[model samples]
Target chain A: MPRASLSPGAVVGLALRIVDEEGPDALTLSAVAGRAGVATPSLYKHVRGLAELRGLVSGRVLAELTEIAAEAVLGRSGDDALRALMDGWRSYAARHPHRYSVLVQAPLPETAEAGDRLVGVMLAALRAYGLEGSAAIHAVRCLRAVTHGFAVLEAEGAFRLAEDLDESYALLAHMVVSGLRTAREMSAADSTPGR
Target chain B: MPRASLSPGAVVGLALRIVDEEGPDALTLSAVAGRAGVATPSLYKHVRGLAELRGLVSGRVLAELTEIAAEAVLGRSGDDALRALMDGWRSYAARHPHRYSVLVQAPLPETAEAGDRLVGVMLAALRAYGLEGSAAIHAVRCLRAVTHGFAVLEAEGAFRLAEDLDESYALLAHMVVSGLRTAREMSAADSTPGR
Candidate 1:
């Protein structure tokens, strides 16, 4: 809150707080500067600009998610690892809905490494399926789609039925694991001669 | 574009055009009013406000998509129907990236019936899968997640690999259909006598 104490990290932290609490529309340079007890132009001394500040927020969110995912999938493999990863992410999204949306805009050019780290954990969970090359990439895409899409839809109140959302999510994870196993089988079948 | 010619439909059409061309940020009552050759205050007679205008856009988008999906899956069943539905949506999202996002915010309160019509087409596509009740709901959710997630991520430039995105989408469709069949088999197994 003091002038001398407002560093770049402090400015980003405040900006993130604003987005997390008041929503993204409130995340302007002026608001961040005001919250930091500095004039609007003075923010130039802290963050490079509003764009960079937003990127920093995305990077931080990605880094945090990567950490959570890495921990959740550690020492696990196959379906066990995949389910853990999805559950862990579902929890993160539920706890910080706004920040979770920020994370979705992740892997910004500046935060590419953080994005890859998160993606790596997901890819690792699929390693046991033994898909390689293009199949491997598509598997990752499929995993992300199921998890992220479900989260976004749920957040948008799209699952209006009284049926337990947890149940639906659990079933979703089950179906995806089944699908991956089937893909592995299909790939194997394709490579086999005279099946 | 004259004031006498401008109606609620005209305002929403202009608003959707703005979102489709210039992105969501450019969509405002003033922008729509200007495009309609009417003052911003005149929008009150055509639509309740910005929110209602936006909701109309979503409704129109949903109606359009529902028609496409209905046509794609007609006379098809099982995996064929599912793939048709997804491919139809992918084509829509590809052609109207911005309006596609608007469709995602859809099924807004004012657009509930339109949303249900769109959803019904999808549910009908899944009819051959034979899942009912909660499983039915979850199946729809899964289908939606895979399709919507894949679209959103692709649009966001998240799938940066050199691999063919179309192929990946095809594989995704295959995987989801396989997953649904598995769910059906599992449910059947549960209902049957001791194995």
Candidate 2:
């Protein structure tokens, strides 16, 4: 077989395709090269090794997710922004289950800039609730927990009841917004004079 | 070499050890047999095959988790029960990371009695908040999402900030309780007559 022309971007794309179709466990250098119609030795010219290839794919996926999330909450705030962000997360996971799994487990960049950017957008949205610093961080973590956990279970078909998922997801979003508001209220009460 | 005296229980014990020490990927019949001082063929006398072994391990892990969670919520209700349940989940995951992962991904029993038993305990806890039917199910999913997501991320060192985890967990517990209260209030409002 002729060695196909492959760039680093093309290599990452092929790797992503492989992971999406066959799951992360099925990803290997030889398999990727085979799928790309390139020799195993020639593939190394694009990506340093399997680890680098995975990292590139992870970075790309995170970048894309962050972009989508940013756009979702662009003109929204408070509960509306929260709903948009949550919807964005669930939709991304639903549309790309394997890639989402990879994103969760993949070795993100050492700087984690892409992740931080996504979190920054979340913080901006939560600002409408008067959260900042540690409070904001905690709320962000809670939001992430709800979104990631629900998405994983949903993808795995763990919610086996006949209930509509949209209703369930909406309830979850409402719960998070309510939680954030309560956190803000409690924080306010703590700083107030006298009971 | 004489074949070791290996019962099914002992085989499962050894498999659990392997998974705890080297992760699930390292778990195999040959590896378990080697560790158990039995030939690979002799291992079949105890477990039918790899699939059965994994199933046994998964069953055992789920059973242990369910028991732990049940005990934690016993003699508790409302926010207290919720806090205990969340702590129970986080503690179990911390104490046995590998087992927790298996529980999440394992092909749980089709009947899922053990899982149902665990959910039953969660439902009992949620009942204190006047939740039932789909409401209870949604609340339970929310609880599971927070606990599972936090535990998974914590185990992976995903939260790199310097903040104390105990504080963060407390905040999360407060958030969940608040969310439940708000959800209950919303449901109540929806049922009430003219504003």
Candidate 3:
């Protein structure tokens, strides 16, 4: 009965710990209850089910990502801001590989409010670089895809080369910055009349 | 018992069908056995187990991706080849969203022959544009990350924007091409020094 005292936050926190120690497959409502020393029904008092529990974890992860991205963009502008934000994301992912995977796993519309906050952070980081309108959105999507894809693969240990992955990541960051600058120039030129 | 006549390829094919219809979570040894019209033990004759079966499926997906990238790059070079290869990958992802996730999920060893083949395809595509050595490797990785990340998020319905994702994808492709070009140039310039 004392197990009923466990709060939703405690349950979710325990779920994350399990995931950190055992990977995503190890996460389940029953497992979380057991870890929390509570019955599955007791967990229902705070969380909906496994799906909701996972969603809760996802919300936390996204929020954390937003914080990190926002911090990375603080007092920085242009390419420097972009790099700092992206590097911050990469650092978070490297540190909490499993939790980050949850963020990437499925798109949670239920957590849209939290997710949007993260998106706002990401967009604001890009804004410091002067990208706006469709170009800004496009740049954000492109930047996200590249950063996340690289992070996921790296987490999965997909890189085969004996070379330092850090080296590759630095190159990736440089490429994204250069890519944004080039896209900015190209779009600018496209909008202008022929020389 | 008569289903004992099925080959590993047939079993894998049927398993892929289940993945297509129901996604990976629906995949189980019992389910595969039932779907294939064989007793679960009979499945052992063709595949090792659930993990092995999944591995087979994952390998098939990776090989298919390699083939598609190859087809896209054939007779193409530079931005054209890059776009073609990425478009080919996107088309495949769209057609086989579930399998695409599977390919990205299972991490393969870099030293493995299959891993080499996958990288070989992408690198060959890059070589068409004069991207060589680490620069070529970095370009291949950048292209892969953006294309893959975009496709997965698209598949997961991550975007809530009003605009068509196709337009977003097109822009993403443009960004990747421009990014790769810029990265290659920077690498070349960095290596050249005295310029």
lDDT of 1 by residue, B1-195 (tens): 453687788777888899999876588998887887778898898798877887888888888888999999999998889988999988888888878777655534877788678778888999988877877787887887788888777766777779988877866886787777777565575479985
Local accuracy of candidate 3 as per-residue lDDT tens digits, B81-160: 88788788888888988877777666454225666687888888777567657767766677667777888877666777
Residue A85 miss distance in model 1 (angstroms): 1.0
Q: Which candidate wins on TM-score?
A: 3
**lDDT of candidate 3 at residue B138, scale 0 to 100:** 69
Native contacts present in each candidate (fraction): 0.54, 0.42, 0.46
Rate residue A117 of model 2 by lDDT.
Answer: 82
* Tens-place lDDT digits, model 3, residues A114-147: 8778778778878766766776777777777878
Model 1 chain B: which ten-residue window has the lowest total lDDT?
B99-108
DockQ score of the complex predicted as candidate 1: 0.54
Q: Looking at candidate 1, what is the lDDT of residue B170?
A: 66
Off by over 4 Å in 1: A1-4, A103-113, A184-195, B1-4, B104-108, B184-195
Q: How much does candidate 3 score in TM-score? A: 0.90
Q: Which tens-of-lDDT digit does each residue in A53-78 have in candidate 1?
A: 88888888778878888899999998
Can you give the TM-score per candidate against the true fold?
Answer: 0.88, 0.88, 0.90
